[model samples]
Target: MRVMTKSALRLLAVPLAVLGLLFGTAAPASAHAALVGSDPAQGSVVKTAPAQVRLTFSEGVLLSRDAIRVLGPDGERAETGDANDAGRGNTTAAVALRPGLGNGTYTVAWKAVSADSHPVAGAFTFSIGAPSKTSVALPTQEVGGGAVGTLYDIARYAAYLGFALLIGAAFFIGVCWPDGARTRPMRRLVATGWATMVAATILLLMLRAPYANGGTLGDAFDLGGVRDVLDTRPGAALLSRLLLLAAGAVFIAVLFGSWAKREDPVERQDLAWGLAIGGTVVSVGLAATWAMAEHASVGIQASVAMPVDIVHLLAMAVWLGGLTALLAALWGGHRVERATVRRFSRIAFGAVVTLVVTGVYQSWRQLGSWDALVSTGYGQLLLVKVGLVILLVELAWLSRRWTARLGETAVRGRAAAVAQPVAAGRKGAGGGGGDASERAGQLARQEAALAKERARKERDGDAERTGLRKSVLAEVAVAVVVLAVTTLLTGTQPGRAAEEGAAQQASAPVSEVPEPLDVRIPFDTGGTDGKGEAEVTMDPGGIAENELHLLVTAPDGRAFDVPEVQISFTLKSKKIGPIPVTLGKVDTGHWSAANVQIPVPGEWTIAVTVRTSDIDQVTRTKVVKIGS
Candidate 1:
């Protein structure tokens, strides 16, 4: 017992630890940043599509030399102007758009890199005025049937299924059948699960590079590209899950032969079961974590939302997976004894109940809108799942009713109430003059009828139960499809589809970029020679201020001090006034760090506004870059 416990604790840590690693550390798929919102809202009609396309990032983005192609309805390139950084600000970019284009279906395809190096690529379509072709082609469901989106959904669903099955199988093997006959098969199952999961994982990991670095598939696999997903919580959690899987494999071996060999069958069973349970626990936890990491949980907000949904999702997986497995086991082993069938049927019922209740609660929490059920991809997929579950509920009811009747026949010792009265009446009729032998023969006939009836009912019940169970499996299979779709939907986008379309239609305000306008303002130097030369260097962390030395030579070579020197800068628009601050007295000149900030990037005029008894003059200077 002690040995098994030690083994279970020491070695069983494999799956848990791996789970911890993978879930806490697994990286997000390569080359994809979840779409937060779009510029041209979905289903919006605009008089003009903007010349420049802008996409906002969840984090600050690097200025990448990406090819952005905007195609018009006739499949001609619509954007005649060049794309450049409109200005410098966090998580925002602007494209120079072309004007005077005719009305048509316009598609804007963009590729960009976030400051963290994760690359993102996607396309959105908006129409100019009323489209020549009123029926627009949505990105989804063309003749090709949702090419990219569907493919993504398929891959995600595959990962979700493999992860769930692997975890579930580990749970049963480690916990329920520790010393059972299927040890070899169980080991094989665990091996298959791990391999399936890791291979899928490697594929996902490979995506990060392309999403971050951009270019071809090879680019995504590069170090910088992979680093993008790995550095984030989503990517880290994924990696951790993979590591846990490898460790679990090793721990599975220790649980049986070396660590558990000396123990009795029952003791070994307990040990194995505990280990399986432990593995399952980890897998389930991580599975929930997988979705949690993706769902916008940042900082303290994550603490509440992730844990609640994780528990709810894990509970749903268990109930659904367990029932699916039970159905497969019972359906295949067709002529199951009535009693065993009854026991399993009861279990399936409870599982279904839990699945439905928890599923509803989780859905309500994740999906915030009623309209979303039909509007969003997530909503539609959820509708499909709900429909499938109702079918499952129906099949479960049929199985329950059949199994209950079968249980009646399996009751021991005596006939049931329905048959008891009839049997008693027959015995009473044969009572007074009948010999013991005659009575015994009559009883034998009665017993045979009861036995035959039990046999008939059971056969019928088994067939009925088997059919119902298979239907349940079908429902499960449908659910898997739904789940896969769901996983994909979680990654695609949510909210603001319409808003994006509208913005696209508005199209850069339909105003031409104005020709540069020059304006002049005079500086009152007050006949004094200019004073100081100052330099300051700015970095992300801190600023290094330099001293300015200026020697003023008056016409008569008489040195004079200019008190209260102040410098202020005005933006190009000058809609905002000059930002003025004092320059303190230094060894050479005056300086101050008290007021400092470069609000926006562009050309700005510096004004050296000086104060002296002889003169109050503002010296206007040319534009300068603050932290170029």
Candidate 2:
């Protein structure tokens, strides 16, 4: 068998690329990715001193998020101190209980944007000095809060398994099964696996949210919500995945077509081979979606991440998906074609080598430093994945040795020689000593038949050797399982290990860390074209001061301030709350919203209509959420 032949290596192109992607950067599901579990045990109570309120989640919660807040029994913010995020599995936030938290009720409300951009939230109350937090604990709300994260983990695992298995079945159909073995039973598994993968893809999209704030089933199908999602990165990635899936449907057509024309080797190769590569390319495209959605939006970063992402997807396809192909070749029960075995060996060698080098580079960029490897969940999971990869390499080495043994066996013809000598002995014994001279002559004539038998026996033995090789490939198939399991583990925090590592490195801040804060708009300046912000001071206790800083542009486009302008706040709605609408005298096309006491936190629509000749620039509905 020619090694690295075109046919054998062509299937390899996608797999090599896929392996690169797997080792290159963490997949979307792994590496500080999603929310998994939460703390406070999600509605448990205790009598002991908790020191600080805590929340545990599935994935690392960004330390920059600001949505976790604790409310005291008296309906006051019980912010004794700041919070800290572990950035691994069980993140802890410290909000000191009101120094004298009276023995009563409390609520811990939290909202978070997961690494997948889905919003996860929940409220848990723990009573002080009591064994019970709530007389009525709500379990359903807790589930609804964490459902996105829960479903995400499930979808990822399902996709990976389906990907590896469906491709494996295709390989089996083409390479292994006897001409008669393509039965209804085998067909069912293939169809089911593909269907599962497609279903998971759809489920993942329905679960993925934009900017977190939490999403729901209604949001999943809402026309406006869908539009907002498509406007974001995650949405675009889903669209790309859908396109790739459509391309994979092409594989389905090719697959059945080939099965129907198995006798035509040309047509079989055309359909089977084409579908394998095409389906693989489309399937691997899912990995690239992460880049499009996350890093690629930045200019320079996009250039680097996009190519790297492509390499990453291709490498994964080669390693995980190729495992299926190689395993089938190994087990396919045919007189194992030496050519096929050699082809797989050659491709595997090159792919593993590429994976190691690129993997190191990708790790350097993502993990940042040696400290990261031990101090971050992303780093630890990567280490575990690498360990599994090394184990796979060792398995490959063992299989390669077996391959070489056969290579030597084929060259030496030792089996034929063994049978030839034994058959010659039997024929010699058959000729009797009574007719000694005649016996010698007869044995010579039988030598040709004995030689022929030896060749036939050696050929039969080849079948057995091929079967043994197939078993080795079966062993190789286990690597895919290890990889899929690793994918799920990647999404979880290596919190315990990372914390220990942080302490060991003396990098834990001298001061206890603060709880994460969700930064909003970076508190940017409002419209900086000399549009001065007037000071509108209002006391919730009922008094108000109106100071208008009106800067009006002159006819020549110059600016001047109308120091003395009338400003007042008016009640907009008589129905709900103290909904205030700000009003100001329109002085030469400029207006201001003066004294306003939005006594409540709901929708405050401030109507500012700047009247000008033939034009009224009216910001009549400026809705804002006050106090939150």
Best by TM-score: 1
- lDDT per prediction? 0.50, 0.50
Query: In candidate 2, how many Å is residue 170 off?
Result: 5.3
Q: Please write out the lDDT profile of model 1 over residues 131-174, one tens digit for every residue.
A: 23323233321210233334434545666666655654444333
RMSD to the hidden true structure, all candidates: 21.6, 23.1
lDDT for predicted candidate 2 compared with the true structure: 0.50
Please count the clashing residue pairs in each candidate, in the order shown. 54, 32
CA error at residue 167 for candidate 2, angstroms: 5.0
**Which regions of candidate 2 fall more than 4 Å away from where they truly are?**
1-73, 76-148, 166-193, 209-232, 258-284, 294-302, 328-332, 407-478, 489-628
Runs in model 1 lying further than 4 Å from the true structure: 1-153, 172-190, 211-224, 251-266, 269-277, 296-301, 331-367, 402-461, 496-628
